[model samples]
Target: MKKLIGIDLGGTTIKFAILTENGEVQQKWSIETDISNNGRNIVPNIIESIKYHLEIYGLSREDIIGIGMGSPGSVDLENGTVIGAYNLNWESLQPVKEQIENGTGIPFFIDNDANVASLGEQWIGAGKGSNNVVFVTLGTGVGGGIIAEGKLVHGVGAAGEIGHINVDPNGYTCTCGNIGCLETVASATGIVRLARDMSEQYAGESKLKYLIDDGQQVTAKIVMDQAKENDPLAIKVLDKFNFYLGLACGNIANVLHPETIVLGGGVSAAGQILINGVDHYFQKYTFPQIRNSTKIKFAELGNDAGIIGAASLVKRQS
Candidate 1:
């Protein structure tokens, strides 16, 4: 049986997999992304990794159907190049498609990582059986993807930069050089900042204070855990996180009115508490019709999402 290759390329690691057309994983592995030489090694490393796996399985390029790749930054699908991937130290358009295709002799399709992850969820996870889906990832930074009318919307080359949506005019500057982007207030960094800032203002009655007083490093997880136990300050901080996130969701609802909004990433590990809070605020801010139609839920694929979503690229064509 012919199989497809799915690759999730990140700044730190490059995850690879072989999958069936139905988005089922067969085998998976990862390798350190060599960011040396200004990320010049990344594409070559990916090609070699895929070939290595093919050899291991006693299969050749002809036995594979195609390749699907999820990458960071704005992707020029027409030419298959990545533009401005700062995390990878990529200064200009990186010719990912040409390199991989030249080296492996396989047709490769690429899309933004967050977009693919969203596609992955829609394919076999939380958003299954739905065509209109929005996936928001609250990780070290916030990112998201949108699928509408049973298709991914590329809207120029920068469609799904959800993290950069302006939420606060007076808020701190985001890594993207924008002030008050959703990522500034709704990401892991944002959560920690909220906890610390709130702790400073109400320094006396918070578990975070105890942690700070004892020199214990406070993290987003610690804050959420404390909030789950009814810590006042932690609850306050989470309120801020949910407010911005929900506000973003409301804004998206007006634009797309997606059927499902799935939350993923490390911050989402806070679970029901996180989803419930965001859902509360989302309903509060969104239109009545949108509020009644959209459902918020947890992303189910976890680390496999990127690969599975990438695989779906091939699945769609087949």
Candidate 2:
């Protein structure tokens, strides 16, 4: 049976997996990214990990059909160059495919992690059977991928950056040097930031305030927990988040009219709380005619989505 390898590279962790053609993960492993010292060592570390996996599985080169990677940066898929990876501190790394092939003797392909994730969902996850779908991941930062007509849209180096779309002209500043980007107010970190601001403003006797004495360590999960317990302040925070999320989704729906919108990332773990909140506002904000057609659902792949998706890319290429 032909096997494939998938690699998902993040700022803090590198996840890899071996899988069959049908997306079943035969084996998996991970390693710390160790970007603290220097980002230059990442390629070597990745190569070593691949070697380790191959050795452990006792698989020869013939057993592996191809390798695919979902990298956290702007990638030139046609040329296999990582133009820029802000989190990885990489710039203009040319021919990543050739480099990896030289190291592992396996042909490799690469693309933006978010785009690959959407593809993964479409192939074997929540997006299965859907030809058109939009995936939004609300993590420390928000990331998105667009799939239309059964093809991944890659305009100008993964230009489907839905998170960077200006949702609030007067909102907080984003890491991308933009003000009021969707990620600034709708991401997991954004939720925590909003909760902190609210906790400070409403410091009377809220559960959120108790979670953070000085508002130093607020997290999305904490805020969700407080809201789930019916804390007024926490509910207000979620209300605001959902309002913006609805607005963003409304915008997306207007443009793409996707069959389904898949939500993933840590914040999505809030389950029905997040869904209900978004759904409530989406109904109120979106175009009445289209609202009923667009269905919003949570992504089922979780962290494994990237690797699974990356591995699945081999099939697309073949």
Q: Model 1: per-residue lDDT, tens digit, 152-240? A: 98887678889999888898889988799999888888888877777778855777767866778888899999999999889999999
Error of 1 at 91 (Å): 2.0
Q: RMSD to native for every prediction?
A: 1.7, 2.2
Between which residue pairs do clashes occur in model 2?
Answer: none
Candidate 2 lDDT by residue in tens digits, 172-261: 999999899989888888998888777778856787877776646778888898899999889999999998888898788888888888
| C-alpha lDDT of residue 90 in model 1 | 89
What is the Cα root-mean-square deviation between model 1 and the actual structure?
1.7
TM-score of each: 0.94, 0.91
Maximum-TM-score candidate: 1
Specify the poorest-scoring 10-residue window by lDDT in model 2.
34-43
Position 222, candidate 2: lDDT: 85
